[model samples]
Target: MTTETRPPAAPPRVDTSRRTRAPLHLGWWLAAAVIGLTLLNIGSVVVRSPNLDWSVVWEYFLSTDVLAGLARTVELTAIAMACGIVGGVILAVMRLSPVPVVSWAAKSYVWFFRGTPLLVHILFWYNLAALVPAIAVEIPFGPTLFEVDTNDLITPLLAAVIALGLNEAAYMAEVVRGGLLSVDPGQTEAAKALGMTHRQTLRRVVVPQALRVVIPPTGNQVISMLKASALVSVTSTPELLYSVQVIYNNNFKTIPLLVVASAWYLIVTSVLYVVQHHLERRFSRGTGRG
Candidate 1:
């Protein structure tokens, strides 16, 4: 061995084949097959349906009434979500307050609003004037600024806004609270160390940081709100779904008008998806999520 030695012989190469693995998954394949077949069956049924009326869908897609309804839907969504963001922020702040009364009131609001169905909320708003006949702007101890009938102030459209907005507030309150909670406690301490007041720290340091956590869920809520806005039809608001229903009620082209509504919703949702995607990309900079 000493006579034969040159440099130490290189160690034999280890085989890596044993490290490679891909077992056949019969269960996975079977599940995939079932899903594929189910999708195909549904597609076939849609293609063969007798009442689809794709033509009517196309014809009324941009009709005046339909467009107006779509506009109203957009308006409601904007107003509702805006109100939601504001009210949600307030409720979230209240929820985290040091005052027991404030915190309890916030908790109760979230509980009731989230617990009740949105449709009931909308209906109640529509009929709220029956419960409280008048609304006023007054200084509690000093002066009555003005007064008006609740029915006059809360039209069907206003009712829709109030209902959807307040209901959305409850859900959004949780979202906002979660986002705020996700912020590092260290950040708040650091802000305070810099002599920042609580409001200043929240507004300047906490809220901006928390928004990255909040935007995705808020966007999803907006989409859901869009769909839920249709429930306002129950209040006889002439928004998209209600408008479609009115048309179908007049003409007997029930499926066709419904198709129009569906098409519009699809278009709006697709636009929202694109917008949300861009927003996510914008916000996900350091996180590398899209």
Candidate 2:
């Protein structure tokens, strides 16, 4: 009876008169700032156009040769990325192997390839036919079984693919390794307790989870590969930059031809960015709710 007479708990101390400021719309301010910056940039470009002809730029981009070059650039990127993914998985496994020799070999490969500039690697591979006169097949520390002329075996296109794929693999191995490392050790333990072998656990439990980590960086790498395909021009593979160069060399409209190449690169990069965004969202779905 005494506890019931406690003055109704002071009306629960409700602060009804307190004023709350409305939440600021920072997004609107950010949009305005972006618009201002874009206008400034456009003004600067217009001001800097000494003897610029917009028509020539448009014409160059619309040309059949430029379209052909774009197609070839797409082809090179597809081939290189496919080869890179396969090689990267192999190298990543090698790097993670319990055997010291396999790990050492993988480490050495990454070291040498990553230490050198990719452009240099491309050039070296292009000239590898001269450096190594024959492509010989033999058992380790045994007599040669067969030989093919290096120049015949390695075409410039093939050389470009090999160089791009091998170089990308060095970088991609690290990406994959990082993804694999991110998976919880407990998951592997549980998989083993459930009678899964190491390889089976890795393939089933580890890689699926690792893919969530691996895919974003791999998308970025694909975008980078798209740009790096230009380097194939050095080997006369007639990719986008090479085709543009050929056009400019003939017509001497260097700026316009470059603009064409830049436009295509921009378009491709934009598409890749869109793909990356969706992929990141897909992977992030379950992560945010908890």
Candidate 3:
């Protein structure tokens, strides 16, 4: 009663005039430094008078073979990503399985694939025909089925796709598992209470919710896979980089050819970034304080 009588406690001393500011203003300082360094670098390049031939860049872009190579690159990315997503979902489920054996197997698969460098995986797949001369099929604890020649069955393209997809699946499995784990247990419980089976709960409740958490990283993975498609050139898959190498090797226009490939990569990645922004917004809507 005495405190309440003390002029309403000075209105609790709200510091309404306290102007909050960032302690360091580091962002503005960093931006200015970056601009200064970039200008300096550009000035140095200009002073060096390095040949900046726009005509060669244009010619490389307009070339039919380069266009074909670009198409093949896109095709490879799509196929590999499709395979990776499917394989990853299966692996994620396996890893989360109640059975110890299934979970262990999934963990081992992910460990082996992820521990190994992707380039090595690609090389191994390319040489898989040499390692295992014949491919055999047999049911578990059953007689062997008809066998096929491994070398004959696996083309370089197929090997590249398998290698990239399987390797990517390992990483994507972790991403998916993380997303699934991020979802509340109550969601699954609620779905089960509503008479949904485990599979139905996962499909209708879990995956849809997890996808919001998954899409950003998955989109980044897709972009990376597009770039990684260039690695197939080591196996002579005639993808974007391989085609550019062929052109330059013929005409010795190495710089121009590289620039062409770079331009296409930049353009594609920029478009992908825009798509990713829209996808993130679409998925994030209604899931939060938005």
Candidate 4:
């Protein structure tokens, strides 16, 4: 029998008439246009203002005094953050402890520190010498075992470090505790079942997993800590803002000096943002948020 070849069937047509176009809201376009124009106008005014003195800004931006102040700011940030991270971990552990008194004490510490402003902490540490002329170590109701002049121990730099570090610890403890809590309860239970001690399980399994949750906020705190280092200028700690203040105080070029300080802050914060993004991506790898 002869086989008949059938003609190829025609391809189906797309339903173009039923296709939907995304909505175009004229109000959104108009609002965007208005905002863009407003920003351009403000920028033009700032860029053209004669009193801003770009020359003065450039002249002192990398001056010796300013560089020294920038170095001080970086040093303080590193040291303070280190202290805060260590103290925060300890406080977070204490806060999570089963012992009622330990948890309550940690809570009280967080409450007191968080309730007080960082500026107050700085001032308090700076003026500690006034409150107590000497720092003493001794038996509670007995003779002093050791004593030292408060001023000798608590210099301006030391005072700034103590203030910034302790204040950061209060905030960081909450961040760490949140991270710890995000960890799955089953992970802890499994580790314990495998003969791991509580501390061992926490250090190995829980903390490693918790890092993914902990890192983003910790990075933000680092950037904030860098900016907050400016507050140390109150105690004449010679950080970035204080250094510029000295320049403006002598030359009376207040706005330009402030611009220089702001420029440095922006540059450093930008770098930190990049680092934080990379870290978040690295930690979020399998989770798909990356």
TM-score for each model: 0.85, 0.82, 0.84, 0.88
Off by over 4 Å in 3: 1-34, 43-48, 136-148
Prediction 1 TM-score vs. true? 0.85
How much is 82 displaced in model 1, in angstroms?
A: 0.3
Q: State each candidate's clash count.
A: 0, 0, 0, 0
lDDT of each: 0.92, 0.89, 0.89, 0.94
User: For model 2, how does the per-residue alpha-carbon lDDT over 19-84 read when each residue is reduced to its tens digit?
Assistant: 898887999889999999999999888557865556778888878888998999999899999988
Question: Which portions of model 2 miss their true places by more than 4 Å?
Answer: 1-50, 138-146, 197-200
Q: How many clashes show up in model 2? A: 0
- Report lDDT (Cα) of residue 87, candidate 4: 91
lDDT of 3 by residue, 95-211 (tens): 999999999999999999989888897888889978898899999999999788887888889989999999999989999999999999999989999999989998898888898
Q: Candidate 4's C-alpha lDDT?
A: 0.94
- Give per-residue CA lDDT, model 1, range 1-290, as digits (tens): 35765798899999987886789699989999999999999988767888777777788888999999999999999999999999999999999999999999999999999999999989998999889999989997989999999999999999999999999999999999999999999999999999999999988989887988998999999999999999999988989999999988887899889878988989999999889888877877777563
Over the stretch 1-290, how does candidate 4's per-residue lDDT look in tens digits? 99999999999988888979889799989999999999999998778988788899999988999999999999999999999999999999999999999999999999999998899999999999989999999998899999999999999999999999999998899999999999999999999999999899988988877989999999999999999999889899899999999999999999999999999999999999999999988888788576
- Judging by lDDT, tell me the better candidate of 1 and 4: 4
Using TM-score as the measure, the top candidate is: 4
Best of the two (2, 3) by TM-score: 3
Q: Show model 4 residue runs off by greater than 4 Å.
A: 1-24, 139-143, 195-200
